[model samples]
Target: MTNKQLQVLKQQHALLAQFIIRLSLFYQGYSKAIDEELQTLRGHLGSNANFTLAHVSINKLNALLQEDGGVLRRFKTDTLQSVEGAAKALLATSGKANANTSIIDTISQARRPAESLYDVTQLCVQTITLYSQVTDTLPKPVGVAVKSHSNEPLQAPATLLMALQEELVQLLDTYQKRLPDNTELTILKQKVVEGLNNDELLNVCLTLLRLIVKDSMQEAIISGKVIQSLHHSLSSLHQGLNKSIDQAHCTFAVQQDDNLAMRKELIKLENDVARSDSFSALKTQTQQQLKQVGSALEKREENDRLAQQALSGQLEALKAQVAELESKTRYYRNRLAKQVATSQTDPLTKLPNRQAYNEHLRKLLDNRNINEQSLCLAVVDIDHFKSINDRFGHSAGDKTLQVIGKQLSKALDDNDFIARWGGEEFVLILPGLNAKSLKQKLERLRTRLTELPFKFKQDRLTITASFGGTCFSHGEDPDAVFERADSLLYQAKRAGRNCVVTDKDDV
Candidate 1:
C-alpha cells in the first residue's frame, strides 16, 4: 500500500469511529452491558492500536447494531409517541385554572435531558416548542386536565357506534353467504345495534381489523388455489401434447413400412410375370400380389383413423384445460382488484387513506398543468381530542372523528378532496381555490362541525377543529407546503382552537 492510501484508510477509520460514538450516545439507555461494550469499542478506535486489532472491536459493534437494530428503532418510536402524548396532554390543559405546575415541570425537565439519538432530537425539540406555544396561549396558570371518575353508563359515541353496527351487519351478511346456518355472528351483529361501552367498542375495533386481515388472507389462499389448479391443468396439457407428437411419429413410421411392403409386392409380381412360362402361373401370382396390396392399404387406413381420433380427443381435453385456467385467471384478477381497493381505503371513515393521498399527490405533481392550477392544502386537527377519549371513551372519540370527517367532506366542492390523515386529523386537497377562498371554505367547515349535535350518555357535546391551510406556490414541494400548512394549523391551535389560519398576506 502507498503512503497516501494508508492516510486515506486512517481517515475512513476516524469517520467510522465518529459514527460509532454517535450511536453510543443515541442508544444510551437501552442496556448497561451494551453501554460498556460501546465504551470499550470507542477506546479501541480512539487509540492508535493495530488496524487488525481494532477491526475485532469494529466487528463486535457491527454485530450488536445489526442484531438489535429493530429494538433500537422500536425504542425511538416509543419515545416519540411518549413525547407526542405528553405534548397533547399539556395542550389540552392549557388555559385551564386547575392545571398542575409540578406535573408540567416534571414533564419539561424529563424531556430536557439531551437526546442526541438520530431523529429523536427533533421530536424532543418539537415537544418543547409545543410546550412553549401552550404556555404562551394560557390565560392563567395551568392545572390538571383530568376530571374525577363518575358512575354513569359509558355509552359509545353515537356515530361511531352506528358505524360499527353497520360494519358488523355487513360482516354478518358476508358470513351468511358462506354458512347461512351459522347465527352466532348474526346475533352479535344485532346486539351491536342495541348499544356498547368503550371496552366493547375497543374489542369490536380489534375484531374488525382481525376479520379484515383474515378476509385478505382468504382471498390470497383462493388465488393460490386457482394458480395451483391452473398449473396442474397446464402440466396435463403439456404431457398430452408430448404424447400426441410421439403417436404421430409412430403412425408415420408404420405407414411408411406398409407402403414399402406394397411396393415390394408390385415389383415381385412384375418380375414374376416377366419370367412366367405360362399365363396360368402369371395369373395366380398376380392374384396373390393384389390381395397383399389391398390388405396393406386397409391396415394403413385403420392406423390413420385411430391416430386422428386419439389426437382429436387430446385436443378437446387441452381446450377444456385452457378454458378452466382462463376462468381461474379471471377470478384471481378480480380478487387482486378488490385487494388494491381495500389497501387504499381507511376502514374507520371509509375515506381514502394516507397511501391513497400519497399516490394522488404524486400524480398531481407529475402533471404538466399542476403549476397552472390553483391548489390549496390544509390540515385539520380536532381540538382536545384526547380529553374526549379520556372523559367519554375512545369509541366516542372515534365517532367524533367520523362525524367531523363526513361534515368536512360534505362541505367540499366537486373538485375538492379529503383523506383521513390518521388519528383525529384529516387533510384536504382543494383545487381552484385561492388563499381567501380557502380560508372561507375552512371556516365554513369549522362552523359546520360546531353545529353537530353530538351526545354521549345523554351529555350533549360541542366539537371543534383547528385548521391550517396554505396555497401552493409555483413548483413548491408538497412536503414543504404540508409543513407550512401544519404550522398554520398549530398557530390556529395557539390562537385558541376552533379557527382557521392560512398563509395569505391579507388574512
Candidate 2:
C-alpha cells in the first residue's frame, strides 16, 4: 500500500485504541458507582425477611453487573486486537491490487467484536432495571440511618450516657409511669445498658431476638464462618492468579527478545538479497542463499505467531480465573448481605419491624403535597391481648400476632402500608385518605379481624381490636399525629373496646 494509506490506517488504529480505552474506563467507573450504591443500600436495608427478598434481588443485579464488567473488558481487548490486526495486515500488503478485499475481510472479521460490545452495553442497561427491582423489593428500612454507619464500633459516651439513663429513670418515676415487674425491669435495664438507647434500636433488637430463638441466627453465624473461609479462598486464588500473570509476563519478555533477534536476522537477509547483481549476472550460490534466507524468514514469522497464540491462551486463562474468584467473592458478600436484611424484619410475623414502620410513616407525611395529598395514620391494638396470652399461652399469643398481621395485610389495599408496631399493636399508613374514609377502612379491617377464627394447634378462637385514627395535617410532626390517634384509641377503650374511633368522634 501507499505511504499515505498506511499512515492513515495507523492513525485510525491509534484513535480506535484511545476510544476503546476511554470506553472501558467509563464502564468501569460506572460499574464501581453502581456497586458502591448497592453496598450502601445493603447497609441501609439492615436485616429481615423483606431484606432477604431484597438481598436475592441485589445479588442477581450484582451478578449481572459483574458479567457486564467482564464483557466490556473482553470487548475492549478484542476490539483493540482487531484494530491492530487489521492495521498490520494492511501495512504488510505489497501493493494496492487487493486493497478492497483486504479492507472488506478486515471489516468482516471485526464485526463480531463490535456486536459483542453492543450486546454488553445492552446488558448493562438491563442492570439498571434489576437495580430498580432491588429498590422495590424492600425499600429503605425505617428509622435506621445507614448514613451514620461506621466501621468503628460505637463507643457510647459512658459517663454522660449513664447520667442520661439515670435522669430518664428518675423522670419516669416522677411521672408515676408504670413499668414491668422487677425481674422484667432488670432485663429491660440490661437491654438499655447493652444499648437499646432509642426506640429504633429496641425494634432491631427485638426483631433479632425472634431469629435467635428460632435458630436462624445460628445458621447466620455458621454462614459467617463460611464467609471467612471463602474470603481466605479468594485471597489464595488471587495470589495464584498474580503468580500466573507474572510467570506469563516472564515468558512473554523472553519470547519478545527472541522475536526481535529473528526480525534482525530477516532484515540482514533482505539487505543481502537486495545487493545481488542483475538477473543475468546472478550466480547459482547466490540464488541458493536467497532461497534459504526466504524459508528461514517464513519459519521465524510462524514461530512468532505461535508464541503470540500461546501467550493469548495464557492471558485468557488468567482472565477466567480472576472472573471465577470475583464470582465467589460476590456470592459470599451477598450471603452476608442477606443476614443483614434478616435483621430488619419481624421474626415471628415477618413484617417490616417498627423501625421500618416509622420510616414508612415519615415518608408518607414528608412526601405529601399538603394541598392535593391527604394522609391518615391509625393505631390498632388487639382488645384484651394480655388476657389471651395469659389464658391460652405465649405460643398462642405469637400465633395470634402472626395471624392478625397476615389478616391486616390481606385486608388492606395494595397501596396501604402496614407493620407490626410492637406487641399486638399494628400501625397503618394510608395515603390519599380523609379521616372519614380512613375510619371506614379501619372499621372494615377490624370487622375482618373479628370474623377471623384464629386457629393455633387445633384451638380456634375469635378476637377483636380497637383503632384510633387521625388525618395527617400539614406542618405537623408525624409523632404528634400518631399520639393523637393513640389517645383516641384510649378513648375508644374507655367507651368500650373493639371500636374504631377517629377525630370525627365528638368524644
Say which candidate scores most in TM-score. Answer: 1
- What would the TM-scores of all predictions be? 0.53, 0.48
* lDDT, model 2: 0.61
lDDT of 1 at 209: 46
Please identify model 2 stretches exceeding 4 Å from their true place. Answer: 1-292, 295-299, 333-337, 359-373, 454-462
Error of 1 at 507 (Å): 6.3
Worst 10 residues of 1 by lDDT: 105-114
Give the alpha-carbon lDDT of every model: 0.70, 0.61
lDDT tens digits, residue span 72-141, model 1: 5434543543454454456445664434443343344333333446557666675666555555445432
* Model 2 C-alpha lDDT per residue in residues 1-507, reported as the tens digit of each score: 999999998777556545534544454554554555554444434432244555565576565565455445544543333243323233223234344344434433433334456654543343333323333333345885544456654433233233334323222221122223424434444454344443534354354334323343345346556757767767766776776677668667766765676577667656656886766444554566567657766866776677677767767876776777678778878976765455446666777765577667666666675445888889898998766756776567768888999999988888788887655778888887887788789889989989987765587777999999998777776656776887798798888999999999976
Error of 2 at 15 (Å): 56
CA displacement after TM-score superposition, residue 330 of candidate 2 (Å): 5.0
